[model samples]
Target: MNINKIKNSKNNFKLIVITAYDALFAKLFEKESHMILVGDSLNMSFAGKPDTLSATLDQMIYHTNAVCTGAPSAFVICDMPFGSYINKDEALRNCIEVYSKTQAAAVKIEGGEDRADIIKHLTSNSIAVMGHIGLMPQYVRSEGGYLVRGKTAEDIEQLVKDAKAIEAAGAFSIVLEGVKTQAAREVTQAVNIPVIGIGAGNVTDGQVLVWSDMLGFFEDFKPKFVKRYLMGGEAVRKAVKQYAQEVQNGIFPSKEEEY
Candidate 1:
């Protein structure tokens, strides 16, 4: 189904929008998801960058192309790199350049109230928009770290306003990430558009998790938001540890695998 149709399809169905970076994971997410976003969490999880803002436009386009090539039907979306879209005119131009790289169905940009104008400009021109709000990693420095948003009453009010503005600007969906469960639930209820949760909560219309977290890639820190589906890192570690032991014993190839 198309993006517009997806929202109308089921208000209660709860679509799954996953974060997949490469072709292999894209295929997996596409199989189980209604849509896939080539999120810039790659900077932290893949490139080993300290944060998301370090990701460059070229890197985002390159990985997004790979994902689009791998999953043709899942309405793939690429993330706009930091500083890629700011002013209305610059927003339009940068958005076009990214859309030209591959058949990515949309581009996700951070910010909410501040970016409403840009979102309107892009979506009005037929570029699908997925808005990111609450605990934006791209602003880690300004945020002083990845903390849960909307804790204070006034902050919650502001978040609600931001979410409503995003939907009014024609965003098909908004990501409510790393917020309190109550705030995430409130945001979901407040916005007409779909709310996709990361660390937000299960009450949202859809849920997205960085592929590495789902597949057990990160070793240093695990946020309370992500739930590991497969301990891939641990599995790999065990396999390699055993392999090392095998090599030392000269039993890896064994008798059967040998020609």
Candidate 2:
């Protein structure tokens, strides 16, 4: 989907967003999801890392390229990994590199009011941006942990301001993550752009979840927000076990199976 379609979907439709790290799932999600994010969460899900901080720009670009290759008609977003956009010039340079190296339709940056200027610079330079606020993973260490936001009136007000600022800075949309349901609804109303939520409730314009979490491939821990749609790991285990049993019994190569 393009920016206009995404913006128009704000009050009309519930946008579906899913994070994909490779071409296989990207293709599977393309027809159904409005957008596919090549998220830095890949560090945690794919590399078994503690957090997303260590994901680099090159890594993001590599995954973005794969997603784009798999879903040529899809709107793909590449995450601007932590430390890649510390300043306006650096942000612009890095974002430009992303545009040049991959087919990502936009870049998702984690921050809000504090990063408005950098967002403005990148947008002014013709780089599309999707703003991320509320419990930003990139700030997990500095913030002490992944905490829910918009619990109080003051917190809700700050969140509204952040949404407005990001929108004002030309972000086509925003991802409001790990927030109180009511507070997330308020933030979504305060902004003109679409607000995609995660652990932020169904009141927002849309919702996003990591593919593995939703599909039940990630069994280490289930977040409160994730609703497992399929027991992928269990199915895989069962299928493999059956195959092993058949092989051990010498039942795989019958006369009809001979080439």
Candidate 3:
């Protein structure tokens, strides 16, 4: 699907975005979700890392390729991992490789005003970009952990400015994460491009959540913004336990089943 469908549906439809790191999940949710992000959260969710700082470009490409292969018709966006895009040249090179190798529709880069130029460069080169602002996980260590942003006047002002800058830089959409509700609302109103919220607020044009978090598959920790739809992890554990019990009781290969 064309990424513009999301950009153009600003007030028409509430876009749905979900994170996926592999082919099976991508295929399963392809029809229900408007977009699938190969988010760097995989560093924590899939790789058992403490933070997103360790996610690599190669890992992102491998996962993005899998998602793209499974959901060919779904719009997929891959995150440009930490240290992969610190400058115009580096950003362009990595983004090009990601787009060329994975066939994802776009790449999401973390940062705000500082990334405007890089966003422009990528867009100009025919590579779509999705901007990420507020509580960037890649900067968690430097920022002193995952604090909610835009709590002060100065913070709100900069957020609005960043949103405008990202829109002007030709990003098709931006992810507003862990920002104050009022500030998130203002940013959504300030940008023509779609704003997808995570912990930001319901005022955004769309919403995104980590797949495992929402499905209760990743039980390591639960963020405040996530809403669990199913106790997937618990269910899996129960199923495994039941299988072991049945095996111990010699319940398998009954008389009617000799092959």
Candidate 4:
């Protein structure tokens, strides 16, 4: 679906968004996912990095291009990494670079009322932006780890305010992450545009998850929010072990496989 359709989907069918870093998985996920995000979470899931803070704009653009190449018809949003949107002018310039270099329909920026000016600048320049709020991965270090938000009345009020500000800044949608369930529901109701959740609960307009986490490719400790649908890592290991056994036993290069 396009941006307009996704925006209009508020209170309608729940949108399905998933992260994809390469062409193969992007194509596989295109049919099921309404939107594919070239998320900076790739730094951890694909690049084996400890956090998302070190992910670069160039890396994001590269993966976005690969995803677009694989799923040409699918709407793709590339993530603007940690330091890429520090200010208005720099944010616009980087966003323009993304637009120029890849087929990404939009770029996601993590922030709220504090980053409204930057979001406004990008949208003003005709760069589509998706807003991200609550438990920002980029703020992990500064905020002292991934803490769930919206526990208090003041926090919930501030979340509503943040959603409104981001909407006012012209973001088509927002990705709300790691918040208390009731708080997520309130924020979703407060916003007219679609609110996509990740670990924030199901009351929102949509949901997103890293492909690796959902598919069970990542064998690391699973988060409470993640529900693995396939034990991909274990299956791969099992198949590889069989293959190794076959090769060692001289049974792999059978008559049927000969050139």
Candidate 5:
């Protein structure tokens, strides 16, 4: 799947993106999601870390490889983990490794205008880049904590500028996370590239969610934007409890045990 298809999907339909850290969930996402992201959120979702800042490039590459194998026909984007792309040369080198090792369609970096030069460098080297703005998880410690952005007029102005800069830098699409609805709408209209939202509301070009959050697998915490479709944690507990009971009661195997 070409990244251009995703770029062209704007305004036609709401592009669906879901994060997957392994082959099982990636295969499931392939059935419906337009794109599967090997997001740094996996640090929390898969590794039980406190936040995305702990994710490493090797972890991202390992998961991206799994996603690529599971969703061979789906467009896959891997997140450039924290500290992986702090400079142009470093960004290019790491992105190239990610692309070559995983065969993912693109690499997503969390930043706005500050990352334009890096984005330009990556694109110049034939690497596709996806931009992320608003409440960057990688910057959470510096920003103080998770918070919604674009509340004030000045903030909205900066957001629009950032979106344009990202587009100008050659990003095919941008993820607007934890942005106010009006600001998200403004950014979506401000740029020709697609804007995918997460807690940024429905006015953007598309929506994305961490697969574990959506499926109710991450029971420790839930964000306001996430709408759990299934109580997977509960379901798994129930199944496990039943199995344990069956085994203790000698109900396992039954007549089929003869086989």
Candidate 6:
């Protein structure tokens, strides 16, 4: 079965994508989600890095391999880490490495118009592709920070151009990040392919979140778009506080494992 067809078919089935860093989560989610993205968001969510730029190709490949193993049948896609796709040859090489090493159905890169050449090169070689637009974290330096894009008419049109270019360049789908509500809808409607939204509102083909963010694992930082599903950080703190109190009172363990 063609994975790309799943995104375009009249089934009207909403694609569900989740970032899977390890085999366990991949195995668990594969059966449920339409796709599993071995996202480099692992930089912030897992490795405590400031953002996605910190994730290396090696680390990304390792997780991609793990996630693919768990997702025997799901469409697996790996994110090509920052700088891996700067030079044309390097981009192709990285795609080949992850495609061969992880057995992922596709690979996602953060760009729209500029990376159009890279997109064409990879897809031509039979590697499926996914496009990421909007708040590209990899461009944090050029963007001056991780703020939203396409607020003005000119910016919005430029965004639309980028999205279209990526789509026309053979990206099976585009990732619409941190854009206004109406603009997100326009892009989705305008593009024939899928648009996976993060902070881009709900009218797109799908929605995704970093697992840690949704679970509230990072207490010190929370993005505006993330809806906390579980307060893991809070729970951990409470448990640690309780353990400290028990240890101080000399009541820890309490003979639970005593012979």
Superposed on all Cα atoms, the candidates' RMSDs to the truth, in angstroms, are: 1.7, 1.2, 1.2, 0.6, 0.9, 2.5
- For model 3, which pairs clash? none
Candidate of highest lDDT: 4
- Runs in model 6 deviating more than 4 A are 9-11, 237-259
Q: Tens-digit lDDT track for model 4 on 35-76?
A: 999999999999999999999999999999999999999999
TM-score of each predicted structure versus truth: 0.94, 0.97, 0.97, 0.99, 0.98, 0.90
Once fitted onto the true fold, the runs of candidate 3 whose alpha carbons sit more than 4 angstroms away are 253-258
lDDT tens digits, residue span 1-259, model 1: 4776667634658877788888888887787888888889898898998888878889988999899878888788889988888798888888898888788888898998999999999989978899999998888898789888979888778788889988999888888888888888888889777888888878888888887887788877888877888898999999999999999999888998898
- Find the candidate with the highest TM-score and give its number: 4
Which residue runs does candidate 5 get wrong by more than 4 Å? none
Q: For model 6, how does the per-residue alpha-carbon lDDT over 171-206 read when each residue is reduced to its tens digit? A: 888878899877788788878888888998888888
The TM-score measured for candidate 5 stands at 0.98
Question: 1-259, model 2: which lDDT tens digit per residue?
Answer: 7999999997899999999999999999999999999999999989899899999999999999999999999999999999999999999999999999998999999998999999999999999999999989999999999999988999999999999999999999999999999999899999989999999989999999999999988899999999999999899999999888988999866678998
Model 2 lDDT on a 0 to 1 scale = 0.94
What are the Cα lDDT values of the candidates? 0.85, 0.94, 0.92, 0.95, 0.92, 0.84
Q: What is the lDDT of residue 57 in candidate 5?
A: 92
Query: What lDDT does model 5 reach?
Result: 0.92
Worst 10 residues of 2 by lDDT: 250-259
True lDDT of residue 150, candidate 2: 89
Question: Per model, how many backbone clashes are there?
Answer: 0, 0, 0, 0, 0, 0
> How far does residue 117 in candidate 4 sit from its true spot (Å)?
0.8
Which segments of model 1 are wrong by more than 4 Å? 254-259
